[model samples]
Target: MPRYNMYYPDYEKLYPGIEKRPDILRVLRASDRKMRYMEKGLKLERSVWDRKKQTIASLPSREISLEELMEDGRQQFSNGPTLDEQVQHQEELRHLHQALCSLEREYQLLLYFRYWKDMSQEDVAKMLSLTQQAVSYRERYALQRLKDFVQNGEKKKF
Candidate 1:
């Protein structure tokens, strides 16, 4: 029988009187298969580690400045919005203003106090002598009305 003493260090201690046992060959075969499987797993792990190491080593080693890192390879910052973009933005604002004007006077005042003045619902409610919940409900209704007006091409009145 071929010796398996090299692979299994405690072969003799684990399976004493192996020569007399009928299943000695079976035990040796199972041990050999397990060792081969473990060796394959180790080889695969080593190959993966080597590939990752090579990839890391191939990367640039230079230190990056904070400003350069923040820029993230952009050539330069734009000066400002283009003229066409500015005109489009202004037109949208005009439409929004027209929509606001079309709303009822109370809705207009509520929106003005809430948005243009940057007041909280509670503050606006206190100023207008209305409950906070009422102010919030009115604000939501006013915004929905504005959205409907804008989306419907400002044709219908609410």
Candidate 2:
């Protein structure tokens, strides 16, 4: 009664309300253990945001650079979802983006490298300076976190 071959992000999106099988949970837990470094990445991003805000505050009197202002506006304008793709693509994108925001960097990188870049576990281990076993553990942990977050988030919807 355990889930197999279940990607956390995909499962979370597809079945936010359903309970996960114990087998799936085991896989996710394994991935999460290897990818704990992602927590550090999230902290780093927060620090960056804090520093940027402080710098902007200090430069209040200075005129905003035109290019920076334009870029900001462009970013804001492009933030909305596009309507061209099929419904499934849009949902997948939405779920992925949500997962990206909620999960740690290690999880994101694992997913990107494995699914997007089509990298093998051995290659990932070499790149991450970890053993294959370690990498696999982190991946499972990250996926589990994603599943839990999604399931919990959905619970709040009702």
Candidate 3:
């Protein structure tokens, strides 16, 4: 446990658990992570107090400056749930893989040629030896069905 002297220059300012006392904290224990997190708001001064006299002294409290720490990128509370988001993206890819696998061979080929191969409708028609109109209609219908299937599968939570 390390002691910290809370230096609030504005004596009129309000802070809990310290309003009635001489602003200096006798003993404060913060975890290593939390200590690091609050590093900017902490301060060290050799002459801030006289331990033998049990009296308060002076040192600026600049430990854990919000603006500085935020810029420095050491704030734990600032982190987002990126791990959860990455897991969610992987899960969606797995679901799409399964959905694609369940599609008919012709529909899968249509999608692969149009999207995966990045071919135009006319090119896809030429590759499949079908009319462009027929290719367009079937591709649109298949994509609609794929979207519906994916949405329904997501609703099922499986």
> Model 1 over residues 1-158: C-alpha lDDT tens digits?
54546564555567688757658757776888777654444322221225655643233334444455566865455669989999999999988888988888889999999988999999999999999999999999999999988888675556
What is the C-alpha lDDT profile of model 2 across 1-158, one tens digit per residue?
44544322445555674355767756766776545433333332221235655643222433444455686774424554466656768776787567667766777888789778999988999998889998898888877776776655532111
Q: Residue 153 CA error for candidate 2 (Å)?
A: 1.9
**Candidate 1 vs 2: which has more lDDT:** 1
Instruction: Summarize candidate 3's per-residue lDDT along 113-135 as a digit string, tens digits.
Output: 99988999999999889999999
Which residue pairs in candidate 3 have backbone atoms (N, alpha carbon, C) closer than 3 angstroms, thus clashing?
Answer: 40-63, 40-64, 41-63, 41-64, 42-63
Q: Top TM-score: which candidate number?
A: 3
Give the per-residue Cα lDDT of candidate 1 at 113: 95
Question: lDDT (0-100) at residue 103 of candidate 2?
Answer: 68
lDDT of each: 0.76, 0.63, 0.69
User: Weakest 10 consecutive residues, lDDT, candidate 1?
Assistant: 40-49
Which should have the higher lDDT, number 1 or number 3?
A: 1
What's the ranking of the predictions by lDDT, best on top? 1, 3, 2
